[model samples]
Target chain A: MAVPEVLLQSGVSSLLNSINSVIQSLGVSVLLPIIIFLIALAFRVDVLKAARSSILIGIGFIGINLVIGLFSENISPLAQQMVEVTGITLPAVDVGWPAAAAIAFGIAELGVWMIPLFVAMNLVLFAIGFTYTLNVDIWNYWHFAFIGGLVYMSTNNWLYSVAVGLTLGLFVLVAADWTQPAVEETFDTPGISIPHGTSAPYAVAAIPIHWAVDKTPLGNIEADPDAIQDRFGILGEPIFVGLAIGLVIGIAAYSNALFVAESWYAILTAGISFAAVMHILPMMVGILMEGLTPLSESIRNFMTSRFEDRDMAIGLDSAILIGHESVIASSLLIVPIAIVMSIILPGNDVLWGIDLATFPFFFALMVPIMNGNIVKMVVTGTILLIPLHYISSAVAPLLTQAAGSAGFDLAGRGLITSPVADAGSPATGVLALIPAPVALAVGLVIVLGIWVALRMWPQRMYMVAGASEEKARETVERRHTGKGGGLLPNKLGSSADVTAAEGRSDD
Target chain B: MTTKNILVVCGTSVATSTVVKEALKEKLPERGLDIGTIAKAKATEAPGKVSSGNFDLIVTTTQLNQDKFDIPVIHTTAFMTGIGQDEVLDDIAAALED
Candidate 1:
């Protein structure tokens, strides 16, 4: 009996070991999908649908890895050569948000916890009347994961990383509530707020700049957005921007062989390659989003159902605001401005890359605050880019480390950073400097204070920024009465009172 | 079967637009609509793309300056939020049929 019992124990132990080895070998690509599958089931998604979505997510990760491999293979050596030829000494490469998002999602430890924590916090805030924004923009949750991963890499503490991530999430919710009015006025999209990490926090920087500009003649100088869009629209296209940068870098890097046909061949090849990267990288991310959409929608439905009676503003991606003419025009202008600033700015070493396309997101919220003044938007964006460059440069090593651990082949690639993901706002930069413990404590206090203030003076807080008094009062009333701000004109029957009235009339 | 071309426009062309495009791909065929080529573009590129490409309709999750295009524009966030998605899909099918 003892011998048979020993044999059974050994067999069970070996089975467990083999399963562990398989998971270790597959790493994040497999593990994340498994986690996602389980989470989908927990959220009550259909079994077949959950399986397909999870598999698609796994495929998306594989696609991202393949594209980053292509990106580094093509760009890294050219980047090194460009640095040598131009003597720019900017060793850090801006890898864009695709690589950044991949890296963020790749960190399984922090990524797994962020979704639950963010949802719980949102619910708590909503329950207490501290916030009226239900942030369903789950795709942008990578911003929290990215920041958390950075803190984990810096402090090597799981608790610290989670704390920092949660704090950033809180800040985004408040920023969204504060900026809803501006979004409504500028974009003509009602009952919507942007809780995006990249776009929301910039409102802090733009508010003071808007105030200062109003005191000067620059505030009145309104550049015609249509004319600007007509003239500089080509700059907004990624293929052209990529081609131009590649050709310039090729010429600079291969200046010694300018007379040789070989040099011309290399230059032209580089141009097309760069353009391909610019075009293909986003397509890869699009696959990731395709896999993510169902999951995000499931999560959104799960959250919104809980607060059905509340007058909550729908939190969405800042991408929704990108259609404004002022945003497009100013973003087009900021492209060249950002490139030049990266090169000439003192104490800055990060080179701009694919995230040049993200300038529209940066300027979207700021444009409305500037009252659609293109000139003022450009000026404020320029001012904001200075610190953005510095912070991006400072965080390059940590970003590189995080990217490497996420299975990105950073073999010869030196330090890497993202302009949009790494240093999208000064708030992230400041938070990165504080010790983890202090950040946790201070971050909690500040977030709680803001929440309390918003709860206490909802109308006043709404009017403090770009919102008009009437709009503020309406929003406050809607939240209290749970009756107005319907997305569709006919969907106004959502409120219980209205439904009751309709039922009585029918009877 | 007449194959209809569609253009999906959004802020980044990478985020919400992809969701809308995926939904259309899944739902349009179920509604007996044959889809030809489904293209994606940024909001700023919509006007240029519409004039240049032969598209049957424009489905967007974000705000578009609809006055710039002669093609039918259907703006909805149903795909992103998962509310009223069936109605939007019906709208798309109706638009394409016309």
Candidate 2:
């Protein structure tokens, strides 16, 4: 009788607690907006805008994190490492909060693979929104929320931190452009920028579908997103060059005796190497294509999905989601071609200084988001270097300590052995090979650098593009106005500037 | 022939330098040099980890002032990354006139 009574009380208490938690969440989501509306009714629209912006920011944070958590789960080795951290044996779960957040952050970044694209997209959107008086503050609101979401997400969804940093960098660049109204910005709120002559109906549909437009005209070419997608599509120039860079690295690695053994797979070493280095997809393609390499398939699948979605959104054939997988594999042939040069002159030491090489690699990876602004990318890179260097230094020693006798792995120990943003794994499995002390140091620095870079890169590009595009639109307006006076952005940070160049990053 | 050594000076002069030193020792015989290849245990700033007169040649990523050493020096972009490792090695061989 006594045991049954105690059990009953405990169950009742838990049920009550869970109910209260759900109620609190619902209240915050529902009541908070109503309260803000009441306040807006009494006060100014700016304050109400501020409240609405905060809520959207909060929601964006929650949503982005949800996606990141989902995607990060798929990184097989990382999941193993997380289990190691907590000393738990359960496999990481997808289709849940964790993986969703990871994917969202990764998708939002859109820079790690194509930095210029990220920059151009944000700039184009900001320009359109600001020029037309759409919900302009959503830009700033999301930017700060990203920073905040990043703080939360980094601690939990460690693997996505690198992508998060890229996102933040882009956000900062966009935020810089929000001073006053362009000739098009009749309204000040984000997403509500009412451009000259475009009424309410057009602004609502234009903001989200800015880049995903179906059929745009030449004079109306700013909305010609099909052209934008083509700029960075699988057949684009960057993927081709990247494949060459990979082939060079692969052949160099091979001759250096990286392959398991010469007695084994040497039939067409040159051809094989090129195929492996196929630079069509950086970070994912080469890792995935390797047969024996230990990178997890799930994470690779996610990357493949992201690249596909990106191609789709930018106006590639929306119907073909998984079609680009073949493109990634076939394009890998270029890596082998460039790598053959190494065999001809195998005597040269092809190593670059770590700082010089990786800084650029990071910047190159970020160039899409910065929209081909090498100067802008460099500025962001420089700002991030000191902190990143210190973090790497600190993490190295700690990793040395944690490594014990397992041989401290440097970069490229397959995919799962490494952490994104160098997040420390749960204290078991693969990451356990990386000692806790070193992992901590690496984790902090890597995450910080990635997040900072992401935000800075995109933010600057967006501002420049938005300002420029506004000018272009005005000039077009003037020409039509019969005045024929001068009024184009004429430089970087213009509104239409975003669409003018989406994937033309030289750096 | 006088006995000589080549020191690959780097920033930390630890892990990567160690790897370079080992790779050089293995690869040098092919170039017909029986001389020992050692990683100088110093950085560009504190390159005095090994004695100045101790090495017959200095190889580094960045150039040293050479006011302190009489040995032949060859610097290339190899120590920090894997980019020009082979090219830099050829440069060193060329410096040796072998």
What TM-score is obtained for chain B in each of the predicted models? 0.96, 0.69
DockQ of each: 0.69, 0.01
Question: What's the interface RMS deviation of candidate 1?
Answer: 1.5
Cα error, residue A91 of model 2, in Å, equals 24
Interface RMSD of 2: 22.4
Off by over 4 Å in 2: A1-5, A8-150, A153-238, A258-507, B1-98
Predicted candidate 1 versus true structure: per-residue lDDT over A1-507, tens digit per residue: 899899999999999999867766777788878888888788778888888888887888888788777767877787789778878777888888888888887887777558767888887877766666888888888888888988988998888898898888888888887778767876776777888888876766677877787788887776798888878665658788888877876787788779999989988987888888888888888887877777777888889998787677788988877887888888888888888888899888877778887887787778667777889888888888888998888888888888876767777678888886655466678566567788777767766676665555656556655676677667656553443333322112233332244455644
Worst 10 residues of 2 chain A by lDDT: A313-322
Q: What share of the true interface contacts does each candidate keep?
A: 0.71, 0.00
TM-score of chain A in every predicted structure: 0.88, 0.27
The residue-level lDDT of candidate 1 at A344 comes to 90
lDDT tens digits, residue span A366-404, model 2: 212233333333333333333333333333333222221
